[model samples]
Target chain A: MSSSELLQFLISGLQSGAIYALVGLGFTLVYASTGIINFAQGEFFMLGGVLAVAGVRIGLPLPLAIVAAVVISAGVGVAMERIALRPRRDSGALVLIIITIGVSMVLKSVARHAFGPNEMALPAFTPGPPVLLLGAAIDRQVLWIWGLTLVAVIGLTLLYTRTRLGRAMRATSLSHDAARLMGIDTAGVVMISFGLAAALGALGGAAVAPLTQTAFDAGARAGLKGFAAAILGGLGNPIAAVLGGLVLGVLESLSVAFISSTYKDAISLVLLLAVLFLRPQGLLGKSGREKV
Target chain B: MKTRRSVLATVLVALLMAAALSGCSGKGNGGSKAGEGGDAPYRIGAIVSLTGSYAGLGTPEQKAIEMEMKRINDAGGINGRQVEVIFEDDATDPAKAQAAVARLLEQENVIAVIGATGTSQTMALRDDIDRAGVPQVSMAGGSVITAEFDKNVFQTPWPNRIVVPFTLRALKDRGLVDVAVISDTGGYGKDGHDLILKGATVAGVKIVADETFNPGDTDMTAQLTKIKSASPDVVLLWNAGKEAAIVAKNIKQLGMAVPLVGSPGNGRREFIEGAGDAADGFRFAAGKILVPEAYGEGTPAFQVAKKFIADYSFAYGVAPDIFAGHAFDAFLVVTDALRRIEGEATPASLRDAIEATDGLVGVGGTFAYSAEDHNGLTEEELVFYRIEGSTWVLDK
Candidate 1:
């Protein structure tokens, strides 16, 4: 392949990687704060796309539709935490996982029934010719995806590092009982974390809807990949999850371009398993120390 | 207090007994109603993907069958007994399809079965369907369904052999020779791909590039890029659903801008929406078109399709896809046959009538069947159309 062609392929890979990173970050955030893996994270993504399309179909402007999608998905996240997760707060991990899976199935079924079993697309937001950089054509959608993902990541970093709420969240993640003693409402933090994660996932979904049309069952694969990225990145580390997602996306793209397109997804899964087997702490994860 | 409790318990027991007896009587009446005309209505069962990815294809099929059933009943109740159809959801899974077929055969006692929308699911349940001496008419385009040609099994859609040759000829007529084929790793895709390859060879077209993708794949940039590098005259896609559209979009994104051809599955609206302007130049074979203009003026088939589309859209609030046409044709064929064998509506009699169907016209072009050829349509029934501004326009 020509260098220009390679550049085009890489650009596409990076754009896709950005979306996966945002979703992976959401997975990491939820897992970091609570030990549960929220499988319904992908459903939140689907909600974003379906809601935006419905809003646009009903005469809302594109920007307003996107905002509505994000808000609605975040609200769903909070409701899921309250109605599904909280009800089984003291239940075993297996039960919690099943409940989340059930919630995902319910959301998927509702979307299928309401939207009908057809793929839908949101109207494009940007009105212009695509920009070309080094022979790689970049559309306005790709620009939005990369920009929003970076902004969300930086904003999340600030929220988690420099704020009082961030410290409280960290404390609660470290020890809920101790954080409660320190006057933190641990339950509120959990709700906030789920909402924020869902918002990020929603943003990713809305941004990629133009590229990958929204279908009722679109979330399952994307959610599973995002979960894989999180686990590969040591389950709860934000920076590691982002890195892992980017790496996985690029690897998948390159595999399709060079190795074998049919086995692209398999490459991600294989890498994830290898990482867990060899370096479970991940590249950027801190090793846990034994308590004396 | 003890005396009052005993009296209340006795009254509750008596009411329960009465309710149970009434429920039994209602069921008994329903059974008798089913057998009111001396013999039970000829029960035909359908296992369609009423839910999940295939629902878009299956739901309309169910509607068409119901509409045909009503029409048959209105026309003297099909030789003194109404045509009854029991439908179940397969969920597009093989195991579910097996269970569904078993339930329809054993519990519903349906004489003949119609549909199991997907190829793999249909194939998985074919042996059992044949074993039960129940005839099946699969709507999917898997040629293997008829390879062994059980007298009990039939196909409604154009087999891959017929569609592939028709597609090749269409491309060849357009002066396209070298082609790239992108197939999904599924029975339908593999079967279609092999047939296309054979047809291309017969047409003396070079196979420049051949690639495969899995179902549920979103990106096709790499495959498209590689195919573009090979610089084929046409890109032929033999997959269904989102992948076909994604490939179209990615082909545009990479600036390949070549003429694209697809299997019948690409005729759905989703392909146009997903590919947007990129799908404009795309061509594919379809059993029927929604627009009357595509069929030109004053053809009998065109008139019927126009009326069906108008009535279907009025009821469903959306234009019907080609599957809807095939389904309408399938329903009409079965109902017409049922009318023929109305007096003796046994499984064997119904199968004989269906197999003997000839010169029948419905939504899908003219369907002619015989004992040897269970599939009612031929390559001549398939029409080629190009995507033009979100609708399929006939390719003259």
Candidate 2:
């Protein structure tokens, strides 16, 4: 590929990589606090986009619509935790994971009925012609995705290090019994993690909706990809998950351009397997942190 | 011991009574109403993609079928037997479609099967349909459905065999001879992709670049970027799912100035709605229901399309797209055949009657099925449409 063509593919990869990173953050957040994978993370992304579209149709401004969507999706995440997971707090990890799968299915069905079976798009935050950057065309939405993902990452890092709740969440992830003995309300931390993860995912969805339209059934494929990204970056490490997502996106884009677009997923799957076989802890993950 | 034996016998008798009563209830209205002489309903099975990637297409198809069923039964039924449609949701999976067709044929005892909304799903029903010896009127537009030539199968829409060559010729006439084909790996897209390759040679066009993506993929920028480097005169998209909108948006986002042309699969309101302004100037070939004038003023075909559009819009609060028209035509073909049956309406007799159909006016143009040809519509029934301002305008 020519230099310009390589740059074009990289830009495209980074755009989708930003989205996968945000969804991976959701998976990392829930897994860190609860020790269970929230399979419904992709539904939060779908809800964010679909709700934003509904908000825009109801006459809200674009920014306001996105904010509303994020807030509502966060609320849904909290509700899911309280109604489904709270009662099953004593349940094993396997049971909780299955419950999350059930919740995702219910959410998908409800979204279908509420949004109807059609793809919906949100207007660009700043609609204009593509910005030509070094002989490569860049969508304005691409900039929005990168900016929002950075903001989410910085904000989450601050929350983890600076806030008391963040410290409590860390302590809980370290050892649930010890954290409880230390008088930390670990359950509340878990709930907040769900909300925060959902907000981050929704923000990504809202930003990307202008580029890729949202639909009722958009969650499953996105969820699977995000899950793969989370696994690629270590399951519990949030920062590594983001890096993993970016790596995955670039890999998929380059494969499509250089090799074959038809085998992009297969190529990604082979790489994922290689990562798992070589280092099961993920790229940035510490070994022996998770038990099989 | 004798007392315990008597109690067990009583319990068994109660269980048998419950089973007998439940069996009677399971028969529904069909058993009670089958008194004699055409009081029974003509059961037809409809397998639709009510929940998956093709849900947008199948929802409209289900609505059109239900609407037509109401109209036909309200007019004192089809030859004194009310048309009852048993609907099954395939969820856009071929396996589900196969299972649903098996149940429809063996259990529901439907005289006809109307759909398996998408091309792959429809093709999946062939084994069951052939085994059951029933007439299956498909709503999908893949040419393989008819070109493969199953005697028991009939299609309502213009197949890709007719549309692909016409589309290629149209591109050639516009002085756009170089083509870049981006098709999905699904049934309809794969089918159209093969035919496009064959027709490009016959239509005197050069195939410059070819790329494909799987269904449900969210990004096509990489494919479009490759196409950009090749700089084809036109980008031909062959996909029936909602993902077609993404290609249009991707082309616009990448600032690629190539005109995007699509197959009949792109002829839907969702395509315009999903792509927004990016959908402007997008072109596809489809039937005349969008612009009834394409049927010609005061023609019988025009009158039928006009009524269907108005009725469908009133019922659903929006205009019917080509999928709806295809479903309407499928229902019309089956009911029209049912009306023409002289004696007992077995699947064999109904299949023969449908094959003998000639010159019946309905939504995707007039129908004329034969023993040799299952898809009756020709190139004349199709017109080129350009999407302008999120609505399709007849391309002059």
Candidate 3:
């Protein structure tokens, strides 16, 4: 590839990587607090897109529609935690996984019924000509994706480090019983983490909706990729999840550019499996001592 | 009292035995003759994707089939036997499709089957239908299903192989020689891409680039960028549904002004709506068009399509898709064949009648099939159309 072409590829990769990172963060946040791999993370993403479209259909402005999507998705995440996850709190991990899978299916089916089986495209965020970068051109929506992803990352980092709720959430993640004994509302922490994760997923969906076009079924693939990225970066580690998302996105872009486009998804799966086989703790994940 | 109860039980047992025997013997011709002046209901099965990725394609086809059945039944039924269509949801999975066909064969006891929408799904059940000696008509445009003549299996729509050549001819006529072909890595896409390549070679068109993506991929920027770099005069998209739409939008987003061309998937309303103004100037072969002037004003096909569009819009509040038209056509053809069979409603007889269909008008153009050719329509039946103002307008 030419230098300009390479730059174009990198820009496109980073744009997609940002979306992946946000989704990965959602996965990491929920897993960290609940010790459950919320398989419905992708559904939250899809819900965001569908809800935004619904808002637009109701004559809401684009920005308002995005906010509505985020609010609705966050509410849904809290409801899911209360109804589905809380009921099965004492259940095994396998049961929790199945429940989330069921939730994903229910969410997908509801979306299908409401949105119809056809794919839907949101009105473009910008009406101007596409911005050319190096030798390649990309739409302004991609820029929005990059901007939103960075903002989400910084916002989440600040929340986790500088806020009282963030410290409580960290405490809950470390030891739920201990946090509860120390006067932290552990249930509230779980709900808050799920809501925040869902909001991030929703933002990711809204940011990419103009580019990818929203479909009821888009979540399954996105969810799988986000989960794979989370696992690759060390499940529960926010920083690692973001890094992994970028790496996977860039690898996929490179594969499509150089190898074969057909094997792009397969390459991610292979990479995830390879990482697990080689380093069970993930790239940046530290191996923890087993509980007595 | 014991004797009274035993006698009542014996009588009930006798009646139950008689019912069971009659039900078993109902499979025979003699048994059918005894049923209310030979007015037996003939069952036709449909294995359609009522849910899943292909639901948009399958749902309309199902509706069309039902509408055709209603039309046929209104016309004094098909050869005096009421047409009964049993619907099964395949969910667009091949394994489910196989089981669905078996269920239709064993449980529903349908004389013939009308659907199996995707190529993989249809191919999965082709052997079972062939062995069962039942006629199976597919709306899927895969050529491999009918490449070798199967008297039992028929396709109402022209296969992609035939349609692809016509598409190339139209593009070549328009002086689009340098082409980029993008397909999905599946049977449908591979078949379509292969045909496009063959047609391009025949038409002396240079393939500037060839690319493929898996199903469910939302991003095509990389592929589109590469294709743009090659600077092809036209881009040939050979994927179905969402993938095709994504490619179209991405190509436009990349600011590549090449005209996009392809077969029917790109011709659908979904693609036009998904790609919006970017889909303008996109051309593809429409398997059928509701041109009242060409098909004649009062023809059954045209009349039905007009009513279908109105009713579909009234019912679903959206225009009926082309798949609905194809499904409607397939249903009409099957009903016509059933009427031809008249008294002999066996699976074998129905297959023979369907194979002998000639000059049958359907929503998807005229179908004329023989034992040698399972695909009823030809390339001549396909009309080229371009998206104009979000509607498919005939390309002059």
Candidate 4:
């Protein structure tokens, strides 16, 4: 293939990679704090996009609509933890994971009813023609996705290292009993992690909605891809998850470009299997860490 | 305090369960057998996608069927029996459609089946229908429904076998010879993809680049990027889902200058609304419902279409799409055949009568079924339209 064609494929891959990274990061945060995979992470993403569209339709300004969507999604995350998970906190991980699957279904049904089962779109944050980079056209909404994802990563890094609540969360992820004995409100830290993860997912949804168009059923595929990315990155490491997402996206794009479009989705499955067999701890994961 | 909270939670759960039970019971309408010394209603089963991707097509189809049912029953019944249609929501899945047809045949005892809105769902219902010996008038447009003809299966909409060559001829007439096709891996798209490949040779068009994506895929840039490099004259989209809008937007995002053409599947309000500005200038070949003037003024077909459009618009506050027209014709085909049967309307007789339909005036066109042909519509019933400013303008 020509270099320009290769560049075009890379651009497309990076745009999708940015979204997978944001969603993967959400998976990592919740897995770290709660030890339960949140299958509903994608539904939060759907809620953000569709609710933002609804907000815009009901006369909210674009910025205000996006902010309202993210805030409401965070509230939903906290409410899910309080109402569904908290009462059954003593239940084992398997039961909790199944509950999360149920939550995802409920959220999808509710969104379908509320949004009327049609695809919805948000206007790009900056409306302009695509910028041409050496024969590749990059959509303006893609730039927004990349910028927001970078901001989320930097913000998450600072929170994990510099804040007291973040330290408490880390301690709880390490050992819930020991953190409680140390006088940390581990339960509250779990709730905060859920909120933060939801907000991040919603932000990704809002950023990509202009490009992909959001529907109630959009969550199932996104959730599956994001989960694959998390597992490919060893499931618990946030930074590694981001890198894993980019790699997966590029691999999928290149497969379509070089091999065939028929095998595009198979790339994720193949990568997950390869990672499991070859590098079980992921590319950047430490070898001695617990397998999440 | 803990006990009081638990009690409140129990009460809430009880209320929720009660509401859900009520909703389930209310879904099936007019299936009563207690008829107060009169004949029971003529039961017909309709399998539609009331809640999934094809919901846009099926919702209007359901509305059209329900409206016609109410009208037919209000006019002192057909042959002294009320017409009642039992509806099942397939949710746009093929397996659900198969299960629904089984229930309709074994439990509901419907005389005929009207639909399962999408192509794959319609195809999925064939086995149960043939086993039950009931007539099925499908609302989907896939060619296989008739090309792989079942004696009991008839279709209302024009199939892809007819529409594909018409579209290829349109492209050739405009001197846009090189074609790039991006079809979905679903039944309808697969059907169109095969036809386009075969028909391109006869229409003197070259296949420059052909790519496909699976259903529910959100991005088409990778496929479109490859298509762009080949530099085709036009892009023909062959999918009915709302994802077609994504293809339109992706084409624009990549700055591809070629015009985009589509199959009959792209002729929907959702395609226009979902694609927004990207939908403008899009072209497709479909029936005359979008611009009913193509039916020719003062003809019988024109009068029927005009009346249905007026009544449907008055009832729903929006114009009926081609799917609604297809539903109208399906109901018309069945009812007209019922009126023609000289003896008792049994399943075998209904199936034969539907196959023998002739020169019926309906919204789609004048349908005439025969032993050799089931999809009775012709190219004369179709017209081309170019979208402009969110509405279709007839393109001569």
TM-score of chain B as predicted in candidate 4: 0.91
Backbone clash numbers for all candidates listed: 0, 0, 0, 0
The TM-score-based order of candidates, best leading, equals 2, 4, 1, 3
Clashing pairs in 2: none
Q: Candidates' DockQ values?
A: 0.23, 0.30, 0.22, 0.27
lDDT for each candidate structure: 0.76, 0.86, 0.77, 0.83
Instruction: Find the candidate with the highest DockQ and give its number.
Output: 2
| lDDT computed for candidate 3 | 0.77
How would you order the candidates by DockQ, starting with the best? Answer: 2, 4, 1, 3
Model 2, range A162-266, lDDT digits (tens) per residue? 999878888887778899999999989999999998898888888878888899877777777787888898776678778889999999999999899989989
lDDT of 3 at A172: 84
State the interface C-alpha RMSD of candidate 4: 8.3
- Decoy 1 TM-score against native: 0.91
Show the lowest summed lDDT stretch of 10 residues, model 1 chain A: A283-292
Best by lDDT: 2
lDDT of 1 by residue, A1-292 (tens): 8987787777767766776787888877876676566777888888889889998999999999999999999999999899889877777445665576667778888888799778897766784556778877777777888888778878877888899888777787666789899899989998999999889888888888887788887787677677666656655667777777777777777887888876877886787668766775565666553100
lDDT of 3 by residue, A20-105 (tens): 88788898898777666787898899988888888898999999999999999999999999999898888855567667777777
**TM-score of chain A as modeled in candidate 4:** 0.97
* Candidate 3 chain B superposition, TM-score: 0.86
The pairs that clash in candidate 3 are none
Worst 10 residues of 1 chain B by lDDT: B22-31
TM-score for each of the candidates: 0.91, 0.94, 0.91, 0.93
* Per-residue lDDT over B1-396 for candidate 4, one digit per residue giving the tens place of the 0 to 100 score: 343234224433533443232112112343655353346777888988776678778888999998898989999778888888889878787877888889888888888999978889999999999999999999999999999989998899989998999999999999999999999998899999999999999999999999999887777888999999899999999998878988998899899998999988888887887787889989999998888788788889889999999989999999999999999999989888887877678889999999889999888888999997889989988888899999998877
